[model samples]
Target: MEHRQSFWENLVVVAIALVLIQTFLDDFAVVAGWAWAPREVLLYAGLALDVFFSVEFLTRLYFSFIRRRTGIYFWHERGWIDLLASLPLVLLSSGPAALALWSGSTIALGRASLLNVLKVVKAIRIARVLRLLRLLKVFARIRNTDSTMAQRHVAKVATLSVTVLIATVMLLGIAFSVFDVPSLETAYQSRITTLLAAVEGDLDRGAPIDAGELAARESSLLAVQREGRTLFSRFDSDYYARQVGPNDYGFAERGDFRLFFDLRPVNRDQSRNNLIYFAIIVVTIGALLFAYSPHFALTVTDPLHVMTRGITEANYSLEVKVPRLYRDDEVFELARAYNEHYLPMKDRRSAASADGFDLSMDDVQGLLDD
Candidate 1:
């Protein structure tokens, strides 16, 4: 049995190492929040990996509880260690970086309170490993090919999951679509300002913005103003009573920051709608679609996003790489006019071929005949 003990010890070591490494990723917060040198995308990537380890730890704990029930189980030293080891992984789950992207403070607080019982996705790559190990270990113990308490527990969890998910989505939809936004003294600034500057550089290098730049900026700024109240006003209840707000939260009735800055919003309605619906629908439909695949045909929305781009853009050969997708002579005139007259657009817009615009193979012969 020393060999059996050896395997679990080794597995625990791996889990412990992963969880410890995951906890340190909050160190990247300094980079993500930087004004000029921010690496938000990479920071988020690290957070995602941390989330994976957190989920793995929780799943193991859930199975452990099911395995230990007898009075002796309570007094078992190894069992005690097995149950308590999951605690460190749990505490690391809520480091600052993970909470930054959380739904408003209200929802975030609620989720934090409930994390003690939470489980991660059952089919993620890590979960598959746990399942495989269990299968191999239990193969000799199968009882006449029927009911186990673990299977029952899984069913109960599934039913509860569906109910909770639907309710959560409903609340977020209302919050996102209908609730009025208040102004916020933001805890974290956005990286969008940096992104917009980069986009402007692309535009300036490509075409004169005197007329065009003013236009895009004007539209984008207006979006910011209109949505400012709706965007920044999230709050915590405890914070409402105190001067700065409690535990860095507030759920104020109204608030905005457009008053303090030379601000503009980008397609505010569309951005908000996408932020709310796209996130929810993509997650909800994705989960439901995968879950129901055993019972029905399902197509995920993100995979179908191609048909959603503008038809004008669809025809603009300059916009996409598909040689046959667009025959836009007009947009070619537009791209060339925009490019040759300017510093020349960099990246995809600059590298796009003018020949592809209207010069089909047939058009070359027609021009020769002419």
Candidate 2:
């Protein structure tokens, strides 16, 4: 039973590692500006992992109750964090599946707003990045089995890594919200109005008969042109041109003007994507460091667990040997030395008892008298 539990725990570790790798790939998709096809692959891969984790969580929960360890399961087992991390992905992944089903219905096919719904589904899918926090909890659990010294060292390093990651994310989020959002929104709005006027041919209105009218018209046209150029410069020239359909004005600028007016959301999405990339790199490195550093500690502590168990059992006249570890480290050497001294002493005592050689002063006096 214990072996089976260990097997599952090891499998869970591997699953978590794969999930983190998928997350990193998703982050790369954002950073490298991957199109929908590649991004969707990563998204589906993440959703599969989320399903696996959800099942693992349920299995553990059921076992916790069956074993009558609800308190330890809830608090010490970190069941809450597991649920938080898995539920979001499950909910987000279901959106697209639900949309696919709805798309085949007559009412859905008739709706012009389905494209907007699809966009919302994509946005929700991106939010699965929040599940990366579960990796930190996994790291904590892995190192918790180490000796006190090892635990202290691992705790310090893990804390530092988490702190740096959180600080980086917070700083980027605050800077983007405070500075970039307002400026980008203002620029976007100004550019939209200019584009709309240009597309309507309002800027081509004839100069007035009066000199003041001619001057004002010329200045206004120049201002509108400048703003148009500024907005155009925000995008790659070729890409902007390609996105501008016959009826559309430029990148993100439509003839209808309704969709073009609300550019703030687009800017916010881009800013969010940037932060997600930053978080992926930062958290991946931290998790890698925290996850692998405990091997050295585990080596020593695993042997110690065996040695302590052997010693405890030896007290009840049961001979026990500390299982020899395969490593040639200090702990291995100590185990060797302990066995070498202990086994010989144990053998001598057993031999003496079998031969009735009791070292008593009364027996020695009787022998001397004889």
Candidate 3:
């Protein structure tokens, strides 16, 4: 049971880390038009990870209840953060896509307000950063080792870096969306114009016009209408009605023939600039993180960890070995104090115990030698 628990706990840590990385890559997929991991892959992966986190939250809740530590779990252990990061995120991230698929149509620019609302909601996926805070819970579970504090501080620094990266990605995504929407709309209008011209030519020649054939050839057609009547519809009656609403469909009129086209196909191709921006952001953020990690550990966490271990140990004589490259900074002063002032005072107190009480191994050995 203990080993199984250990395994799952470790798995939770890994999942937390993976999801954070995946969420960042997802921004690249969605906003930057990164083909390496497409939007579909990231969406499904995010859903799967969200499920895993939900299960983890429930399991932790159950165990905490059984142990009669519900308050500790929810409040102190940040079970709320787990729940916050899990279910709401799934709905926010995947909900719009699911709705789009169900309706068999993309929300048109006519519903720009609703589209903007969805964009803001989608931006809430940044809450996935909350998962980083849960890493602190894992740190609390870790055994008291010399490296544990160092590991925790490193995790904190990493979490902060990732949070900043995510924020930058969100801002960039918003900027890209502005340009991308117009580009997609232009593409849709161009396709509709070309098809309208072809249909007009066919009408002039009195060629048999088959909306089904045209739609089949055109992957983006949700439905097609002639003379403002439902000539051919790919949607069910209800969805078709929804598509014909004033703002939902685009129309082109020539003499006696009126043609209406569903504009949802515009989403199939992203703007070229989106792809360029995606590459630049991903490479730059990745390079920055790679360069930052070692320097952060060496200068900050390593020294703090050494001081922590020295201070916590039972031995009064333990000395902090300041690294050769270490500056005469706060950590250096801490080490100097530990080795000189603190250790000497502690040793004097220990030596004053003439009855040889509470003597450590070094003290006993020294006494034996004398």
Cα RMSDs, all models: 29.8, 12.7, 9.4
By the TM-score metric, which is better: model 1 or model 2? 2
- Model 3 steric clash total: 0
Per-residue lDDT tens digits for candidate 3, residues 27-128, read: 544444333225556666777787788888888899999999999988755577677667766666454544554476544422224345434533543343
Candidate 2 C-alpha lDDT tens digits along 1-370: 9998899888888888887777667656554555445655665677677788888778878888999996787665567667756766677653343344346321120123433442343345344444655666556655444476566565556545654564465465445444545544335445544544444453246421232332243221211123233321223556434432211121232222222222224334553664565476456645555564556455666656666754544332322234345547767777676567765665577677663333657868988998
lDDT of 1 by residue, 1-370 (tens): 9997778656645544443333222222321222212333433444554455445445555555677643344332223323332333233323342454453232121213222111121011111111111111121122221333333333334334433443454455335323322212110112223324444565557742232333344332211212333222223334333322111221111112221111112112222432343334334433433454322211222111222232223233223222233225443344334444432343344367532244566868877898
Off by over 4 Å in 3: 10-45, 61-81, 102-146, 164-319, 323-326, 338-370
Which prediction has more favorable lDDT, 1 or 3?
A: 3
Off by over 4 Å in 2: 1-7, 92-126, 137-149, 152-370
lDDT of 2: 0.51
lDDT of each: 0.32, 0.51, 0.57
**Ordered list by TM-score, greatest first:** 3, 2, 1
Choose the strongest candidate by lDDT. Answer: 3
Local error of candidate 3 at residue 254 (angstroms): 14
| Candidate 1, residue 253: how far the Cα is off, in Å | 4.4
lDDT for position 305 in model 2: 65
TM-score of each: 0.22, 0.46, 0.49
lDDT of 2 at 38: 61
